[model samples]
Target: HASFFHGGPNGSMGFKAIVNLLGIENYFGKTEYNNDADFDGTWGIWDEPFFKFFANKLSSFREPFFSAIFSVSSHHPFKIPEKYTGKFKKGPLPVLECIGYTDYALRQFFEKTKKTSWFKNTLFVITADHATVCYHPEYLNPWGEVAIPILFYAPGDSSIAGVKQAVVSQIDIMPSILSYLHYSKPYFAFGESVFDKNRKNFSVTFTGNYRWIENDYLLLFDGKKSSGLYQYKTDRLFNNNLVSKNPGQVASMEKTLKAYIQQYNNRLIQNRLTPFSDLNYKKSQTKNP
Candidate 1:
């Protein structure tokens, strides 16, 4: 089973049969808005709760099942519940509001799950779909950017906790799971398992402005033009110019970025885009991209 936050790009309360099929909002909760473009600002939705509730279902089932809960909660125009306004520090980044809300909900959920039997036998994985989109102008780095942080938490006879700063992505989830089960490769998964020793220890981001990660440095591109390079190791905020200082570093990184782009675009051309279930995608999403 899969669910996502409401209000995504093809979500429109099931309007046109064609528009309704996009399945963009298939995993999310809907907002209370007349027009799809408007933000109704409802929180406590399909994001973290979707994960919590589905995990509950996973716990109850006698048969083995695959459940995925993707969140749109931490994405976006950052409209959160009004009750949290001034309850937490909201002045810095708008993403803070959504993150705060999601985090609290998730922590409570984690505690509840830990006390359950499923927490003992089941392999639990918690990770992010992507990073927060930074649109704030005063933000030290690039104006439009998002961060994706992947965390792996597996239950054992005793609690095991581990944290790493190494780069990871959502694509790595299934492969990691398959490997843990000692299963063979999945047919459509493009990512190498995060556990692979030979796997390159870097990250990649695909936006209109594409990015590549090699060690500590990052290179961004937008198809025809090369954007700039920065080191996440030193410039944590992504503010500063390293493109002039490092020419060779940019060359190798750009090649890696292009290879990923080609692979992604090729898949896009080949795969059929599947629409959502009746209530999923078109119930409500932003009409425009």
Candidate 2:
């Protein structure tokens, strides 16, 4: 895993903390950190060099592996490299240009990796940590502000190529990956499998208050009660509060959201995330067993 920040094998927060808690810190062959003085500084390192470093580490590994690379060039203070200044299209926000540069760098990385032995077997999941500056009014609402792309690409197979119209959240990625690997085990997750056609897609977020989206309806809760409801499909701006107009829908979605919040909160407080009492549980257990 190539992390642009949070240096060392075990950082206080982020991915390292989770890995350490799960006792899988030693499982990873290489864990690259950009905060090392050798990289100059976190802001100084660009996408190209970082990706090149990642490619080198990936090529060195002999067995199947899982890796994650987080790019920092497109982050705040969004400075474009002097040599590639005019290479990208400029937009309202400076981050747009930075995004273009990152996109180009990603393409180059993929082009280089395609020739490697590990390229064909890789499953690439691309997503943003958060949404950036909004340019259009349509994307200025709560839903639009939180909207970010989640894409799944399998180089070895084209069977899952088509776009899924159903909404999926970041939490769903882990279950989806496990499902794709045909992992046979009982696990607890707040997210449902994205590949399950019968499952309803939903997402939950908290800014100043809790916001839950299910189907076309969005419900806003103020910890104590649901304050607002909107049908995002019809009212993109969320200008009209449909709490009174759609009582049944509001009640149903509110109940579901409250239940989700209760489950999530209780799980977090109880430290019940792991399926096994010990971290060394075998993955060989059959589905029915």
Candidate 3:
């Protein structure tokens, strides 16, 4: 069974659509906006107490269940609860204090769950859907602009505790989780398993044009031809362009990126994202070029 917990009014709209499409149970905190004292008067409920409320509801689920919870108190306007007004220090950005409040809320939720029966066996994966405003120069480029944290936590397992020095995208999370669980089923996914160290994984982002990253280099491709190439590992600012110098690398990366674009658009338009639907098909039969 799968369940989703949404912490705000409008936030639930998108999540509810996904949960309904997947035919799963969902808890929208907006329903409690009228009576709950935790409401921030702007957003729905404050994450501090709402997380505790989420914990109570999560306890009702049976074993072998999948759950997703979203926190909204860290959003815009960035207001904490009345009692926690001066609790968190305000940094250069207004969102910092709000993040601190949500951190406290997550701590409370974890404390409550630690004593629960399923705590030991649960694998918690934390991530953000996208990156937001940047205050630092390091995140000014295309790769850094879309980069968000993806963390895996298993409280009872010491083997899962290590810093991974690999580039991975959010699309890789499902395959990584399945790999960790030793799942042996054949599946179709655009991303590779992060647990497989030998596998070469890359990520693509489109901000007007396509930016693809593999190993240490970042290649920028406009719809027609290759525009720029940079070794992002050494040149964090992306000031130098290697397209004129490295013709072979440009040709290789552009070909790969075009194949990715073709596969993504064709699969999405034709509704053949699954392996079952893609069987007995050839690349020549694809609609998108």
> Best candidate per TM-score, number?
3
Collision count for each candidate, in order: 11, 0, 0
lDDT of 1 by residue, 1-289 (tens): 3223334333443332332353423343333312443333443343444546545655665545444544456766776556566764565677787787778767767777788765766666777644455554544354235455566677663434666556666767877778767895324455667777687766666666776666677777787656788876677767786887888887778777777778667546644222232223334433532
C-alpha TM-scores of all predictions: 0.66, 0.86, 0.89
Misplaced by over 4 Å in model 3 are: 10-13, 32-35, 279-289
Alpha-carbon lDDT of model 1: 0.59
lDDT of 3 by residue, 163-237 (tens): 887778888988988898898977788888887978686888888999888887788898898889988878888
Report how far residue 57 has shifted in candidate 1, in Å: 2.6
Query: Please, what is the whole-model Cα lDDT of each candidate in the order they appear?
Result: 0.59, 0.74, 0.81
Candidate 2 local lDDT, residue 218: 84
lDDT of 2 by residue, 65-150 (tens): 77776666787788876889799998889889989988997888898899998898988888988888877887888889789999
Worst 10 residues of 3 by lDDT: 280-289
CA-only RMSD, every prediction: 9.5, 5.1, 3.3
| Higher-ranked by lDDT: 2 or 3 | 3
Which candidate would rank higher by TM-score, 1 or 3?
A: 3
Clashes (candidate 1): 11
- Error (Å) of candidate 1 at residue 219 is 0.6
